[model samples]
Target chain A: MIAKELKRGIITENSIFVLALGLCPTLAVSTSVKNGLGMGLATTFVLICSNIIISIVKNWIPGKVRIPCYIVIIATFVSILHLLIKVYTPTLDSQLGIFIPLIAVNCIILGRAEAFAAKNNPATSLVDGAVMGLGFTAALLILSTIREFLGGNKIFDLMVIPGFQPMAVFILAPGGFFVIACVMGLINYFRGKKGAKAKV
Target chain B: MTDTIKLILALTLISLIAGFAIGKANYRTKDRIAAKQQAARQGAIDAVFPEGFKIKEMNDDGGILPQKYWIAFSDDKLSGYAFEMAGSGYAGDIRFMVGVGLDGKILGLTVLEHHETPGLGSRVNEVASTKYIWFPFGGDDKTKPWFTEQFEGISTLRPIGVEKSAGEWHRLSEQARAGLRDRNAVSAITGSTITTAAFTRAIERSVSKYLEELGGYCCPATRKKREAEAGAAAGENGEETEGGDDS
Candidate 1:
């Protein structure tokens, strides 16, 4: 159980893909390797930090307003990230564009604040954030790598196909829709197999 | 009453633990995070120039530009300078960096920033289509060509100054200059004339500003070399340097 917390707890493949959290940036900035990485890393930071905060104050939050309280904490962290990125990492701030602030609605952060950290030990929650965030980042990288490869040619400019004429649609908004749909299908297929294995 | 007190105690202990953990994590990673960000910003500056050049000056206009930068070369072979360049592009302000070399070459030109609409007007940085379109073309239409190769080989140093001349236009290449001096010379981007002219005029005015402010921009080398060999017939005749003024 402890080991699982570190591997797939915070940012799980299911939450980000199967359940579909943080779709805004996932679709908007997945056009290239650089944008994907920037959005992934930034979102991870916000997720980890917000999870820890919500866990700390979980008991103090009024039962009637726990949801609103969690949102405020998450929004606060997102705002700080926005300012710091604007001052220090102008390029990425521009690349990620408006999606950065959409972190407020990024269900992954909010969902974890409500589900895992709000009830678990701070240590376990921390581990959960790291692992889950990694899972999300990994999923993003996989999806973007495929989309960029087919849509733009070259994985992060590494040139995987030995020079394929980009499929073109893979880089546009429609391409994002298709890539996410395919990834969601893969996740569902594997998850169903696991469910069957468990039944056995 | 006793239960409430117990709840408060439990909450206090959890807060203490959470605080300690967060503080430590940030302490461990703060240095690395701050350092990485610093390096990235510095890297943006270094991307424009080659090594061995030291920044001899620094200034900023402070209105969105935030900085005006000038760096001189140790060998005196090149002096590249950059100023915040902006204009009312189709969508909004098109922000970019324009760096110029001492030999009148554009050391490098990168659109450092922008806010233009994505699919239609953001092709400014899409170098592949930049030659022809002033704006972006959605997926299937991207590789479809529309630009004439006439503008090929033209760079900032060749025909146009950062500033436009009255009835003047940017010459794409030295070979192409003879045809560009006419007031009516040069056609606009097929579809987005406003954007093309905006970008052209923006770049032309910018290059011209640095040229004029730099005290004497040698017309591009190919032309300069020719003007030198001919001794500028007007100079040999002791007549006024007519075209040299960029009139």
Candidate 2:
């Protein structure tokens, strides 16, 4: 059951690439691989922590005010994460800047809390959160790799090609959209080809 | 209803716990955070005045930005002045420290914080492998460290200009270097014109306030002449007239 959830979240239903949730931070911080990884892990931690807490208290939460309760729970984890990052990792703290606080509103955590955690047991909800968080992190990694390699002519600040002229646009806002579009397009194109072969 | 009451109670309880947790975290990190901030400030000061100097905070002087001003002494003699200044940059506010020799020439400058675009204006504080500011046409050699180093030895007599008219990153000629020393021209960063201009304006404004505060100081002939030039410039600028009026 846990394995199925992991596969489902990571591949069958990716939050960013497939379901297309939480695209704002996806575009904003994917300018570099380091930022993408930082944001991805931060969001992941919030997701896992919120899901566990929400599942434990799911029975106690009133149905009419469940949404508010979930938000409060998610926000608590986000605030904790924010303070931890600010104190222990100030470099990543300043780099992510506004996005750190904005994690409270990231749809992935709330989406899972309402969709899966509300009805699942604590153990199941924990697995679901971990898998979903990994999915988000993987998607961000792919997008950031493409953007950073082309835009910065480096991967994790290491220059790949000595004299490659980096396309500056790839690291900016518009470039994020372009990279996301192309990656999703390529995925769909292969999927369509696979579907055609099945028909044959 | 009883259900509504329970809901409110639950929400309040969660809020209380969250607040307490955050408060605890804040308490634990407060001292470390302050120490880190002080270390960063010390690093900026060290970078600006690589030549040894002792700096002390001056309480009575209020500059244009209401920031703390520090007096630097080298070898038991007044060496320069260091103060904080902030201005609107291309993306957001740019805060930096300026180190000026007693003769009004810039000893060094260090950017404290800025939110400019990366790979462009954000390169203001980028450190280079070496200290020398290379001449133009140095390929990608003219980087962040080079830009700030250009201000060194340039006095604050005149407003600096971006290299817009020249359209070339040529080396400063002997005459041009003299102009730089005389505070006539300080070349701006080639690609980051707006950020460069903002920085220049911040320096000019802060230097003006610094000169005003130093007006009563008994200094040498050169310091007196520089003071007169700064005083005249200060008189014309009415926007920041508070410094002069109060004194």
Q: How close is chain B to the truth by TM-score, in each candidate? A: 0.43, 0.66
DockQ for every model comes to 0.08, 0.29
Shift of residue A110 alpha carbon in model 2, Å:
1.6
- Residues B1-247, candidate 1, lDDT per residue (tens digit)? 8666765655556555545654665666577666765564355455445567664545422211223455656576446664445656665565554455655545544454555433223434432322212222332333211221222223554444222232212224454454553322343432234544554566565555455445443323433455467774322221221111122
Candidate 2 similarity to native, TM-score: 0.79
**Stretches of candidate 2 above 4 Å error?**
A1-4, B61-67, B89-92, B115-155, B162-198, B216-247
Q: For residues B1-247, what per-residue lDDT tens digits would candidate 2 score against the true structure?
A: 9988998988888888878877888888788877876787787777777567987765432323233566788887878777666778777777787788778878888877676654446556544322112222333443346567777877675676655554222335667656554545566544567888877887776676566556634323444466577784323333322222222
True-vs-predicted CA distance for residue A92, candidate 2, Å:
1.2
- Alpha-carbon RMSD to native, per candidate: 12.7, 6.6
Q: Which candidate is the best by TM-score?
A: 2
Candidate 2 clashes between residue pairs 3 or more apart in a chain or in different chains: none
